[model samples]
Target chain A: MTAVQIIDDLVARPGEGKALLDAYMADYAPGARARGMVLDRVLVSPPLWMDDQPNTLTIVWNVEGAAGWWGMRLAAGADPSATAFWETAGARLVSRARRFAAAPEDVETLCNG
Target chain B: MAKFTALITLQPGADRDAFARNIGDATLAQPTLPGVFDGGDLILHRQVANEAVPSDAAIAHIDSAVYEPIGGGAHEPGLRNGVYRCLLLAVKPGTPEATVRQFESETLAMPHYIGTIRNWRLSRVTKASGARVWTHVWEQEYADIGGLLGPYMTNPYHWARVDRWFDPECPEWIVDTRLCHSFCAFERSVLNP
Candidate 1:
């Protein structure tokens, strides 16, 4: 499936960072997969970022379409497991900024430009 | 599964390496700790890499997250995965060292807490840039939040026995705490635990 979105939850501490990733994987991944979202990779710092000020993480995800993204959010709200997971996971963060990111084609366009 | 974790910073000039080593070895002890929900510990340096060779000064902080990972996240012993309720602790200034040790021993005793609290841990931070707002940490995990806080915080033993050393009103409360939540990503898990 062609990818539709990417998310990044920038965090400070490793333990908390790890928790963020696991909640996505455990509570959300199964439901998300049924609707076409896959957890692509979990990236940590060093080669993962500059200067190690952010050694925590940057999670990348791929969804089949915008519909799938919305589907996941709605499903999370209705699912007690997902809701509970986020409750604990969300509090661990120092800061979180998630935004739609460039797909491979978008990246290609930028590279060509 | 849910988890709650907390931290505490080691004093300067402390034998930090020994302190870290002691906790590591404690988890590996012959008989498992009671009410730990069959979980173990993972030691981290500044929240990045596992300092297999723990340093006396390390990277200014150390975290001992207790978990029981799913998907075979490791069973025999070591950090496990679950829902965690982590807490940050601030020590009040001038509370004699002996009293602090007394409180530490009291908290660790199993009778004071409930069984659903699968895992509990502590971290000692250094004077590094990674230092947190609080110097110490502690946590316990539960299946769900439900009413864990009300009961745990109000346990007669905790308030009557342990509260003497704590003061939320003090400018520098001898023991100040905040609740947080987290799960084990186990990003560094070699076997995917």
Candidate 2:
């Protein structure tokens, strides 16, 4: 049971930061939930945070662990809703920079219902 | 007004019954965001489904969306009664952005029940998952179904411009419409009015 933190730092069209969240909530979130991934939190950097980009939305998803994350991705391959989620998310993301890190032992579980 | 939309899905190694309980607690505990329809929350497999939506997917995710009345649309000080007509689009692959944009703009401008409320939510499919095909969703609510069947449906602007775009050759896009009766439960007015 490998626990890894999946963070996606995404950039969307100007003022389309909301679209990124909407796509996740409406399209991506459920699909990930199906595979045991909770896109539980979000952080948006100030427009001036980046020199070139204006709108950057950072979405955080805590999988049960690395095994769980990979398992979900595998399950999503044949799932129609999962497929649709990617299609929907792809159009909204201008760029997505992702990283995986180890989670702190003293983390809180907000929602994994 | 009772207006909440749910999407349900099933997945591997997921508990159907226990997950329900988690969603119940999660939904109750989830904080409300600052928005028009922010009272409702989501129920995920074992937690709150992200920060929004109470629906169930055919695959593994269940979420929801609760619509609130617009300015003065609330019959009283709170929510109101209205007929909800929601359209979830399943667009064909490679549909031109211009075509989609045009369709959205045209449909949005169509005639509708005056004083009635409408939410033309237009979006694109950007991610992949168990439940696919749904690209965008458009919401409309009126005092009666006639609003959709009458002006919204019959308006020449809708038929001539918007309808034409939903061509028979490319019919997979926006293939279904769900009509629900809004009501009130647990003290909050909902969408299907």
Candidate 3:
């Protein structure tokens, strides 16, 4: 199976970064796991918290392949809990986005398969 | 079906009906307009089965289109006085064909997640005459203004997922930000019209 990576890049509102991260952990992460994604990593850019400026939370997740990706989407779409988390996330976030990507070695298999 | 849609900004004190006649039997709407909609005064929709939709000559700032439904033009004849909304957008020039298809698929997926859309149509613009050459028209009906502006807008499937294509901040964005988001109250199903 080809492995796929999904990234959620979120920039929190000034002074609210840590709280946003806490919310994602409490509110979003469990639902994400239920949707067939495996939490891969959570990275904080600049590796420090500051009250005056925004902090970026980069969340990475993994699923098997296209099927796994679509499965996650279908499940997430049907889940109101997932919707609620994102709706509330806006208040804490300055900007956010989710991107799909693959590793260099898996690119060919992903494209062909 | 052949369809024609127009987003018209009326000249000061222009009579709505007289100006609407230029577009030919359109279901005209004047719902609460939004900022992105560029202060449009009317949302005009007209459709005919297997016939050419005529042109318009309204002396107002208008963004109009002749299109054929590409997806989801289900009929709901009994629905009345519902809010009808239309979004006219162009995929940026030079976006990959595959990405454009993905955008279309994601857009069509909205009905699956949001139940508030009572009737909907996604169309490909065959002839565009407007402030910009719009590529697609997405039309929908909601039971009330609350459904159009509330759950429809607040739903995660809308803001988090499908919106990625429209949000400039997202790398997945392909559609230009200058979109035509106009809606108005309708007496009957415009999709049926």
Every model's DockQ, to 2 decimals? 0.01, 0.01, 0.07
lDDT of 3 by residue, B1-193 (tens): 7788777776677676665555555555443355435526777666743223334443457787888888884536568878788988888889898998888888888878777887898988888867678899998888888877766764556754787787543557678767788887777777754
Worst 10 residues of 2 chain A by lDDT: A104-113
The DockQ of predicted model 1 stands at 0.01
> What's the candidate order when arranged by decreasing lDDT?
3, 2, 1
TM-score of each: 0.31, 0.34, 0.61
- Which tens-of-lDDT digit does each residue in A1-113 have in candidate 1? 33445566567554454555666677766865664557788776544433325456677777644344445544544556643554466566566555545566654332222
**How much does candidate 3 score in TM-score?**
0.61
Provide the DockQ value for model 3: 0.07
The model with the greater TM-score, 1 or 3, is 3
Between candidates 2 and 3, the one scoring higher on DockQ is: 3
Q: Kindly report which residue stretches of model 2 are placed more than 4 angstroms away from their true locations once superposed.
A: A1-113, B1-5, B8-79, B111-120, B125-131, B169-193
After superposition, the stretches of candidate 1 with alpha carbons farther than 4 Å from their true spots are A1-113, B1-82, B110-112, B127-133, B168-173, B176-193
**Interface RMSD of candidate number 1:** 23.2
Q: Summarize candidate 3's per-residue lDDT along A1-113 as a digit string, tens digits.
A: 87788799999988989999999999889998999999999999758887889999999999987668767766865777876787788898888878877788976565434
Candidate 1, position B2, lDDT: 21
How many clashes in each structure? Answer: 30, 63, 0
Q: What's the best-to-worst order under TM-score?
A: 3, 2, 1
lDDT computed for candidate 3: 0.75
Residues B1-193, model 2: lDDT tens digits: 2123444434655554554444553312221122212112222211112334334452344334433322122332333343444444455568787766666665555423223344333333333222334555455455555554445543334432354344331122333222111211112223222
